[model samples]
Target chain A: MINSPERVAPDTLARVQAEIERLGFRPSRAAQSLKQERAGAWGLELNSAGFGRLGAILDTFLIELTTGAAERGSHVVPFTAADSAEPLPAYERLVASRVADGFVLTDTRRDDPRPAWLEAHRVPYAAFGRVWDDPGITSWVDVDGASGVDAAVRHLADQGYERIGYLGWPEGSPVGDDRRSGWVRATTDLGLAHPEWQATSTQSLPAACRAAAGLLDQLGLPGRSARPGRPGRSGPGVAIVCASDALALGAWRVLVERGLEPGVDVGLVCFDDTDIAEALDLSSLHQPLDRVAERVLHLLATGPDSRDPAGGLLLPPELVVRSSSKPAGNRTTRKEK
Target chain B: MINSPERVAPDTLARVQAEIERLGFRPSRAAQSLKQERAGAWGLELNSAGFGRLGAILDTFLIELTTGAAERGSHVVPFTAADSAEPLPAYERLVASRVADGFVLTDTRRDDPRPAWLEAHRVPYAAFGRVWDDPGITSWVDVDGASGVDAAVRHLADQGYERIGYLGWPEGSPVGDDRRSGWVRATTDLGLAHPEWQATSTQSLPAACRAAAGLLDQLGLPGRSARPGRPGRSGPGVAIVCASDALALGAWRVLVERGLEPGVDVGLVCFDDTDIAEALDLSSLHQPLDRVAERVLHLLATGPDSRDPAGGLLLPPELVVRSSSKPAGNRTTRKEK
Candidate 1:
């Protein structure tokens, strides 16, 4: 069996180094070779576990980066992650031979081994999402989910919906937590007394829909805490901000089944304006796919040191007010701004 | 600069050959290093744009094949051909890096430069789709589109519509011809005269919709046919089979705008039940994505030389009966079946 790098003989390393040199790469050998060959394409390794929204978002982000880079002449390579989602063997081969130029890691856990693997190999990689325990050495692009929640909250408040609710994936997800933070911030800023159980999360969309139902039950609009409903803005209207469109759509389906018109009876806002959102006219925060794609590619090609980029590029997402979430007074909001 | 085998200096060749021996590989040490480390991933360097349905079918077939391999402990890597639709530089890297365990090529054109490239580089591969001229090659899998089209025609005939038209891509597309041939043969078997003017291919959906308007105006409902006084098949229902769902949806949109319901007024069938098709509730040929993904992996891991599985594989598609296409019965061959 071939030994690990630790057990590789000195002479063998020298010979491999010489072989690598003959490949027309510099002495930084493995690193230089990898860096030089980086412009070809991105090789992402992922597996499908049915409804992988996180996977979808990460993939979309990665592809956008690659597409953007391709416009500038670089390519993106999609390498499916092994079933285990462990890429050690793959990494060893590529690093040893200086194959992939760079990488973009996604679905990073709190103590992600992927970022460390790339870091230790001196590989130039950027994480699609961020890691909390990151060593400050890794570069990553993340969504300002908090801001999205805030937008939803402000819209709901303007529409005179005092009792708004937030629904989505478990807080274990970094993004979910960020979104929740924004929700809390917005409610606190408006001096609204948010009930402790007004928010909920679940793994599946059906589960999320169920949770939304429960939240609505707990925060019943008929309780009459705030009287005198305004035109198109008052009543027991509830604003639901979801982490993803699938969840949001699922909620909308439930509402419709119960004879409640989404965007009218209950304002619904979902993230990621995927095609489904457009067909249903579900209001969403439009993530600029084109711009994101370009940025990802630029970082991969130009090098990680190219500049951290402004605010790390939190592309402003447009609050597309559709039937789900009305405007600030014209249709849904309390006052016209 | 590094030179090809023919242009290499004898001394340099000998030195490289010696290094290759040291690495337990042949020729360039780089290639040997890659071949020695086989990750459970297969590489497919097929053209995405020009490859045709044959290419897409092979892709679906491969996805099916790969699922099994993955289940058996292996993953497949999906990659596209270069912009020029060739793999010279891309293939070079794939070969030397041992990126894919084997090569699987789809949509192999008649004058394919890929086979030659593979042969010159000693890469092992399989073909899923093939150009008709390569009759002697036993390395491919092809779906009998003629039969598929026949089934579609028969299905349409079972319904009560007469007056039919074929929505197809350019004839150069292998699968397109196969399906069109099926359509024509079905009509012939029914002893009905097929009209050439009924077929059409536009640059895009909007164009197709515009053309559809004209077709509808000319072949108006039973009593509305341009040839006045002659009553067409009661209601003179029409069925359109688009080469792709995108086009089918476009046609459906046009019909709806003109106050015509798809399944009720006119029948439609599309190929490749893409995402849009499912939500739109349109009938189509369901490409077995799971089976295809599984099969590709299986062929890559077990069928090919495992050194380079960049060949093609074709999987059968399923005809999903939706409301869009009426049930056949007394339907005229001119209408559909």
Candidate 2:
């Protein structure tokens, strides 16, 4: 009767609820689960390499997911795979034991085995990244990196930066290529295409610095004198858009070493508005993590088949403008005012 | 009979186990919980301010805890308090619903209500930080910040640094004060007491930079000529020990702006060997998170009564040597070799 309040009379229901509150009575989760045939929990696999490192966004997403799960009268069970390369065993264990009713997947990559295994087993799951191996799978929500970078490029152009260059990761990574495509698209659209102006590096700081230094040389930035054989588009109006905050830090360090101010000497922007970006006052793209978490939960609750026929949701990131994107001329004019 | 193999005949047990494995007949967790009267899960509270920020160690700790719990045939349920200041209600909710058998606490602070509330209710719990409110509470595993800072100060002094300055957070935080105390003790012990050389700032980069810059000016560093009437201790042999990686970053920026390289120009060390420290190559104190996680799980399983009467555990942090702690003179000698 208490479980189904509608079955009781209104007056009796109120009286019984008051008495239960007075007695501090509550049903045990185990008993409730046994009756409901559900775990009331979701399994989240933690791959140390994917998160818990510096400047990773998954930690924030985990917090949001945990909070949202609690609000929806469920709990999040965090676990880790003994072997990250083959994580199906861990997922299978959780399912076999009935510890979780569903799973939330992250760090999605090409040739990933998880989506196929879950689908074959008829288990419910939702991914935070695109299910790269299967286009038919729409149970995922991811931030559109390409559109985010494009927006950043357009933002720099609007700020009057004529010679815009890109500092990005090595080609072949899906995310890296996605972000680079945005730069290519935006620059081509704006009639400021300089395909030779960009440089690639690994995520390491030193490598990024070396790459950024080389890119700066190609663009003829931080030096007023133009190279004899290179293009004449150089100096204060030049800007660089990085694929991530770590890459931006490298570029920022190089700019600092050359005695150049980020906004005044040259405009700068990067992806993933992490603390590094905020600390350095660099412009960046902010991922809509809260919306992503909400959508993932919604997909898990309402199976993919019950959802709209549309494909995976790709939300555009919002551009966060800071002092790094402001030109020196604009700052001087504002000061004069 | 399968649960208690000793009660069954050897041949019967083997045959039954084989049949169970062949059929993949694993017992349901909900049914097991109903029979065992335990949730088989531990609750972990996530306070956004306490973690999920840049350069925080809590995210790493969560991963370790999750992995440890799984090894012990348990799960960790992460939740958020609706009201962080008064988290007892959330704890009570979990207890009333029996969603978790015990709780694992983090970010323990002075006058913490959770310990007292848990004690009153006889709920098992363990903390990652010291339970500051009551001396009798021994269910905690904490990193000795004071000893870590002390070791850092001694390391700088051993490196032939004469004027060692301290960069720390504003007073009143228990953890910050504990770390600060180590610097005071170490400096006095080493006959290099200069209490006046310390500066405090919040965790923000700009505030830390301002504080660090002011401290450097007082020490007369980054300049060859000493200020008239001031002590002549400003030179390449000076060093600074910071309370955290964030503060060290501030001091690093100041040094970079003045064209002074870390280790070679000024020796530096900070606590929490986070990713920022590794990326910047700064020497830092590494907390033993794996041991901490193992101990926390032990406490949860054994309960407070089964443990030794000795107080809470305090593990010392290990110092990770990197380029930031090496002296310029030392590097020059190595180059000559």
lDDT per model vs. reference: 0.58, 0.87
Error of 1 at A122 (Å): 11
- Highest TM-score scorer: 2
Task: Looking only at chain A, give the TM-score of model 2 against the true structure.
Answer: 0.90
Q: Which stretches of candidate 2 lie above 4 Å from their native place?
A: A4-23, A222-236, A332-337, B1-23, B222-236, B332-337
Report the poorest 10 consecutive residues by lDDT, candidate 1 chain A: A26-35
Tens-place lDDT digits, model 2, residues B62-113: 9999999988899998888998999999999998898998899999998889
Write one digit per residue (lDDT tens) for candidate 1, span B1-337: 2347768888988898788778754132234333444444456653534222211233334435444544564434455444545566666555554445557666666677776676566665656555355554445555566666667767776775565677776678676777778778886787543555254554355556555655555555422233443233355567777777656756665564444556677777777775445544567787665654544445445543442244345566788877678544432442320
Q: Write down the DockQ of candidate 2.
A: 0.59
Query: How well docked is model 1, in DockQ terms?
Result: 0.08
